[model samples]
Target: MGQRTTVATTFGSAVRESVGSSLAAVDAELARRYPGDAGTRQPVHTVYVPADVFTAGTVREWGDRALAALDEHAPDAEAFAAVLGLPGELAGPVHERVRAKLEREPVEDLRIDFEDGYGPRPDAEEDAAAARAARLVAEAYADGTAAPYMGVRVKCMEAAVRDRGIRTLDVFLTGLMEAGGLPGGLVLTLPKVSYPEQVVAMARLAGEFETAHGLAEGRIRFEIQIETTQAILGADGRATVARLIDAGAGRVTGLHYGTFDYSAACGVGAAHQAPDHPVADHAKAVMQVAAAGTGVRLSDGSTNVLPVGTTARVHEAWRLHHGLVRRSLARAYYQGWDMHPGHLPTRYAAVYAYYREGLERAAARLVAYTERAGGDVLDEPATARALSGHLLRGLDCGAVGTAEVTGLTGLDRAALERLAGRPAGRGF
Candidate 1:
């Protein structure tokens, strides 16, 4: 009966055009919100060195220095074991293993800083230094001494130093290109990005550099330093982190929080500026939310305390750094900045302890979840992914070996490998 009186539905040209335009807008917005594939191999930490102090083999040198300091302070594996609160039986072996790892791969990521680290120099001198850094990096790449992740931090793009930043970046890129084609995993860091426009400008400059050097169009990615209050809260009073990433036009690989600068922006006194300060926490939280699942990696700021001088002072410095690193790792930030060679040992120690301490529980939970398929354990996909990631990350950072993970989780090598290859948010 209803079919006998059926009515046809049609849209006028104007209405159809309007609907099409709205759909296109929605599609564009969705595309903008989509998180693209983040590259593989996010390093556990980044070591920042003054450009002047940088050399081709600086990573290995730092590792050697760290081991030497350990020898001087701890003297024996047992003493070092006490420092980390590790069992007496496991201390010596762990110490040797960590030392070997450090010597072999002292720095996962290295940043040659031209900002506070290098300060301002004569234009010609800065240019020469940039070129020299490029040459060293080139040599390091050729010699297989380059860190897996390496980059330079150029000055902020604020008006006062915008041109300076651009010039330094250009000089560095040109120098690096002349020395050799751009190395893999190389990223330029644009610091003190207080506005989205700064990110856009940096992206444009990177594109220009790539084109000028005949590099791939998207080869010149950069990291944004969330240093100022303005960077967190844009001029419009909205969260700016996502906007900043968008401004990078898919060239932003990481967002690193600058603890001191952010604390100073909050008017915290120098004595109060620490990585674990509430102010820093707020900044990191903002960054985490803004960049979560966006494929842009996040890094916490450095612990300014350096382990130097007498044994007592060195031990004290190590304690402070360890606390900071532990706090960062607890907060799910796998990467932070190491300001000195002395920070290397504590960085690895803290990271290893964090992962090692939780391995047993995490592995058990993961196995149960995988077997039961989420029954009494209340395991969600997120939980499974996180558990899998923990062990995989432990392996990646050299905190544990494949044999250990397999033994602990009852997962064969193939299973662990499968978990390692699985992206986040996927079921095991």
Candidate 2:
């Protein structure tokens, strides 16, 4: 494939380039204003709605397992504590029965098929299954009042037969949206993005849908999953991302790392043998680097080694999880998925902790320097060094908001002026 595809766009280069430049500058300003974080953000922390949730069954086992997993990792477990019944927890007289019924009731499962003459994905039965899950999603977010930021990884339109799968998602999601089925953000997750053109096609579809539905938000955001070797290979990773960014439809929220399939593509000996294996780490590095400057967020693949139990198993796993998360975070990669909700805290802990400390240290240093510079062209050697230091910290926090540091450190505008070093002798 050619490095640059000759795709025609309605938008002009000047406008797009200008917009892109303005966006890039704004990102810098945001870092300076907010936090010094220049990291990738994959639409915040979330869970994958499995396929089984929508299937009617003795969901007891699944619920129990999910709860057990939550008991270990879900950072917001206290909110859902009633399920576990913590102190002052009210389960009611028939809590178990109620719980059982709730569990038995089908939910939106992206993995399994649901009701309907057909289901959620593999056609008829699959579409029906998807609708049920959609309905469940509506109810979960308050009677279709609002849907959380949910994205469905529908079957890609790769094969001739699979065209219907994508269409079903279109029809299904359209109906759902029409019926006030909106959560936080609606995203279409594309499984394997081979080239930029695929993104364009999807974006076009999204625009069409948005226009047809008159969605309050006239944008169909997309999350691209990079699973195949083709996506990750080639040292010219930056070129690949530039294309995606250009072609990204209205909304391209994130670029997710697909571990298993990626490994498969890489021809790794054992899938789970060593995620941090040099090969894996290198690939991750490429993904992180490519996403660094792009507006698109990056999400590392899941840590497949789920904890064995609820008893400090997470803590044990933390060393490894923290290692990978910290490295990714340090490299400016944000937003990683938690296959088991239990791992949520690890994600939050690592990210929050990293930024918290990193920001604090950066702020303290920057604040101390402010006492002397006196508003000079931020180009003075000292100023350059300070700016560089602050920028590094900014990258780590996924922000570059140096001003944000002032608020945190209790340094005022005056401090910034002094540190900025007042035009080198414009008088005091």
Candidate 3:
């Protein structure tokens, strides 16, 4: 047998000591700038309702309408799976979960839009609508019918509507405060952000609101909508989205792509302005990289195509939306916007199928990785984290049951969270 060899350090203790303080500063900056994912369940989709048309029953109404659409069109699991080209194995599970989700909590996130969806209105009219939206949202929460997340999308910070947008936001938040404090699920979205200054302004506004309401300093967080070309690439030739995240002051929860607006800003014709367009993909790719370790989520934009008209037309629209959603998921944009009730069925169907089809393989990989059992594919710790996150997301959206995941991987919720490197139950 060969004699054991001793290993020697390459650098002296004095050299490490000399850089320790500087490295500590770098460590602090990294911690501040690259906080990991917020462990809270991110919604699979955000449903937008025009503020003027929103009501306490809006969420349920959307669900019911989507259910009706499924009934009139793809009436069963096999039919739905066929529309989306779902695998045979996933047809039953995905369809059943989609229906159950629609029946139970169809709208994961609801945004009472005061931007493009709601359009401009008289000051008094907008104020009333804002207050009304707040009241209705509060009532929904009180009645246990509110979506898991609910908020409003105020108009842009462009000089034209800046003050009006601020006023509307104030009215809405005030109304929520009056109606038994802000709900835990309260969400806010600032749209058409073209500059980091605007993000800083938003953080300041949130800070002011917190101070005035005697709430925690960072209690009010908002998502920034990247609808302008400037938000993606500043005239300075720098990636502006990254600066926007830093400007958020730890209060930005998400970055939502605006398909039409961004596409138009890029001079793309309206007909070619779709989520899968090369321009759209580039914008989202920038967003994905910018938000990677910032604990900020990314949401893809919606399609204007509606599933109306004849059965064939509806089916065609469903197929298009499902393909777009699945493509977005494959690209790591897990959430998107649904502009109509008709989009809901396809949205859920696509999401459920994506997760269901990959559940077993992900679970098996995770089990192998955790057990240190060599498998066909060698997965690193980072890959193990990704695998666990996939399973967790599957669990979150009802695509896979906790029991099923546990049975497959022998991991409970806590184990999954640990492996995913997220603090259990952390959130906004």
Candidate 4:
């Protein structure tokens, strides 16, 4: 959650520019002339938050209950969602209202999270609420731009959460599609993801949903949230993730560490306890390695800390501190989440800053190296070897754009297309 991407000195102005203009176009233009191509498509920066976190705003009272346990032992999250008693279909009319409410809001990115599977009330109301929430989430999604990322957090596979999962899916998806259709990519957040079999089950259900809706195949994808200690241990942990990938069969798009719930399962203490506890850190890295370049995005969990305080100075402090935290994680090559709209700037700033500084220096050096070769072009022998890796790394560091990469490497369209998944850093 606190992981930041690269950051820059002029981040303040950069943020203003990004929000005001066609960021995609501006970015594309910058990448055209650099030493390499700048065809990065995935947001070099993004913010994420579970649905439950949204209901809390910045208040501490809604704090995560399993803070310590999550740090110590990654446990089954769906079980918690079960305990929260969330699922079932809403009465049709009420469903429509919730959907409308969410659609009107200015929110762009939202995770329809099921906080805990525990709570009071075990009846239709809960189902209605779940349905209502999903509908509203869909509406919020509809009102935003096409880029607004959306996800559905179904109940876990535990007996308690299991039954609710299908019902939740059945009820909410209908509303979601009707509202604005699924997001660019529909992310199904799986909790308490213990084994690959659970993923298989989900995939089966996804298949059915696709058939029923007549949607194109493989349009749905999985995002796993590891929560239990049992789920993260030894060979069992590794096998489980591999299995999940197999189960989803190319449908698993990303892996996200669930800090609080994992801590709870391992007997960790306090929600505020550091997310990167030794055990948790190891587990997250493992998942990352397992998922690397499978085209599956790997994400660090959220920082539970609320951005609060009364003064503008204090709020800026919140931003800076979070910027550092997110920046740290971004260093690990993990994209982090932002719980609120205000966090958007932090996400991009860190990313832009990171790529901007590294790229500028690298670009300058690259240009100099080309000159030192006694030529104005990039193809001299000495310059070639020196700049090959630099070009690739520079591209990774966001220094040069796709066009520049192409110019130097002579990589074709397919190569540039591949680079699209990675971000660029012209620091525009």
Candidate 5:
């Protein structure tokens, strides 16, 4: 109505600045919560043994026994080469390297499983077993014989067995702290999680245990097993993995796939409950999508076809197990479960072959891409990351040495380390 009304154009800038600041804060918070990858050394596989059978340095002892059996059966590098499908020229070196690794650090991760592996027992007996495990863990720590990563797998939080799970965890933690405090890099594995509430409850309980033991908050991290249908698809008919992670409140270290139970939940026949089955792939993809860039690790389930006896049938079973492990490796799941000591050879064989097969090409491509030399080759940041990750994993698992990596990539040790730590393209 007025003759000289002036519009306040400054308001838009103020609104923009305020919104930008708020968004920045939110982005910072998200980074803090998710925080990219942890850069920790993830074990290639976790070996589970029954709690009752566990003893101090049992992992080492079992590995030594397994090596003796392997020697008895395979006898020499050529014999082992036939089983691993390696060139005759590579047989002796591969055999000696694996043997030395087994002798030195046979078990990267060990799980004293109180769930399926140890079934149900009387409360008193279960408590005693938990105490024994605690004593063994402490002794392993004192003797420096503990695996680089170790944990205990408690039972599910189903209403019928929730108390048992809690009691076992409580007893184990109490005994562990009373003995010598929690071991470094120790984690708890919570199996058969079916709901976000289950994750929340477990995290809350872990927090309580830490507090009671005077340990720092978030010191007790746990891995969740995605076993049930509800675990993948929430009761609300939505994929609930992200929800589960959020419920963990930053204590979730990994999400492990449970092949058999998940297959059974989908009504798949036992004969068809396979790792690479379409349904299993779907669940793993969901987990990957949910956990990508969240710093939470992923592990595949085990192949139950154990190589037990020394017969043609046993060798066939070993071949099948090797194929399964290879398939898992191809899918970028560097970690899986090893159910029996007999699985060790195939585990290392598949892993080593995977890295070795891709080494030359991956190194060449990475070097070219890093130098910005296109040369009719198309390379993306994702490819660079994958190559770097492969090499880093190979180094971590002792499948390849630092000298080999540096030689192949033409990068010095420090550069390789920096490349491994960098976020792909930025450094490349």
Candidate 6:
């Protein structure tokens, strides 16, 4: 038996007590900066529809069009997989899920665009459109047909259209309130954010809205569109995106990349502009790092390449979009923008294949790590968290079945979520 000995220590509680307030300040700052994930389902993509063209049937129409494109172009699992170069084993499951997803919930997130998509209109016309958008969106949600997340993308805070944008936003939000308070899925976007002051202004604007409507403070949140060179690198050579997050005052939900606008701002020729371009990658990389632990999600920008015309042409465009989507997924950007109904097919195809192809392996590794069983590869807590996140994301988007995930990991949804560090009872 070994005798128990009193251990001698050099520094004790005195040192901790001396630095307590400083440590408390640091803890508060960390909490403000990196609040962790919101424990909610982040949509796989956002669909932008011109405010003038959106209607009650817009969502259903998009789904039908996407299904039609798939039927006409790549009708079978093998054919669709061939187009996207997916693995053999993933062909069937991915195909089935893509079809089911398109039919069940084609557009997870939709934005009524008042910016480029609905470029400058007469003041009265824009006002009317914004109000109409609110009405239709509210009705759709009431009928249980709306997307999981829906919002309006107002113009920038630039001097040219600043007042117009503010007026349109007021009209839309007021209309939503009149319709029957704001829907739970409501979102707002501030585009072409070039300065942190602009984000601060937006936060203040939202605060005013909350006050006017007698809602709780900080109830209005928005996304900032990263489109300008200055947003990535400021005049002082600092990373401006970090400041944008801080300026948001906890009202920023995401940072969405604006593909063409940003590419052109960087002096990239129109023909050479794409999400995979080096300049685009650099900007998004900066955004990814700035937003990493800030509870702010990153959404990749859209492609201008449309899948229209002949079958061969559609296939080419599909391949292009699919490859780009796969590249973004590999880089950890789970969401992007879909410009048209035709893009939806490949969007789901790419997302499904990405998650499905890696599901079993991730599940196995997660199970091993959680059970503390010896395996060929040892994974730490961080890697296990990543694995759990992968599965949860797959489940959220319908790319992976709950039953299959449970069978593989021997952990149900609640267990997996706890392992992922999400607050309990917050289902995907």
Displacement of the residue 342 alpha carbon in candidate 5, Å = 0.5
lDDT of 5 by residue, 50-143 (tens): 9988888688786886687577667688887797677765677677767877888888889999999899999999999998888888878788
The positional error of residue 217 in candidate 6, measured at the CA in angstroms, is 1.3
> How many steric overlaps are in each model, in order?
0, 54, 0, 69, 0, 0
Model 1 — which ten-residue stretch has the worst lDDT? 419-428
* Candidate 1 lDDT, 1-428, residue by residue in tens: 55577678787889988988889988787666655434266788888888988887688889899888888998777887677667665565567767877888888999999998899889998898888888888888888888987879988988887888889888888888888788875878888888888888988998887777787888889899999998888777899888998888888989999988889999999998998899999888999988876778899998787899998898888888888888888898999999888888888888877777777788888888778754456877676767777787787778877888888778864565455445443321
For candidate 5, the 10 contiguous residues with the lowest summed lDDT are: 419-428
Model 3 C-alpha lDDT per residue in residues 130-234, reported as the tens digit of each score: 999989889998999999999999987889999999999999999999999999999999999999999999899999999999999899999999999999999
Please identify model 2 stretches exceeding 4 Å from their true place: 1-44, 54-122, 143-148, 215-218, 234-239, 271-275, 310-315, 366-407, 411-428
Q: Write the per-residue lDDT of candidate 2 for residues 1-428, one digit (tens) a residue.
A: 66886887798788988998879988776553333222221333434545445333322344455455544453343433233322332222122322332234211222222211123344665656567666655554564322225546765546653476566567657656855765654556776676777778777777777677776554567777777666665355444644554576436666777766677677776646344566667766766666553446677766777656654565566556656776676665655655553454344445544554456555555545544444332334464344433433333333334456556656543444344343222211
Task: Report lDDT per candidate.
Answer: 0.82, 0.52, 0.91, 0.52, 0.83, 0.92
Q: Tell me the TM-score of each prediction against the true structure.
A: 0.88, 0.61, 0.97, 0.60, 0.90, 0.98
For every candidate in turn, the CA RMSD to the true structure comes to 5.6, 13.8, 1.9, 18.6, 6.2, 1.3
Q: What's the C-alpha lDDT at position 216 in model 3?
A: 94
Error of 3 at 305 (Å): 0.7
lDDT of candidate 6 at residue 218, scale 0 to 100 = 85
Better of 3 and 4 by lDDT: 3
In TM-score terms, candidate 4 sits at 0.60
Per-residue lDDT of 187 in model 1: 70
For model 3 the local lDDT of residue 139 reads 91
Highest lDDT: which candidate?
6
The segments of candidate 5 whose C-alpha lies over 4 angstroms from its true place after superposition are 1-19, 87-90, 412-414, 422-428
Candidate 6 or 1, higher lDDT: 6
Give lDDT for model 4: 0.52
The order of the candidates by TM-score, greatest first, is 6, 3, 5, 1, 2, 4
Tens-place lDDT digits, model 4, residues 62-154: 122212222122223333222222122212222232222223322333465654533334657557766676665565445543223556677
**Residue by residue across 1-428, what tens digits does model 6's lDDT show?**
59898999888798878788669989899998999888788999999999989999999999999999999999999999898888899889888988998899999999999999899999999999999999998999899999999989998899999999999999999999999989988989999999999999899999999998999998899999999999999999899999999999999999999999999999999998999999999999999999998989999998999999999999899999999999999999999999989999899989888888888889889988988886999998888878998999999999888999999999998898888887766654
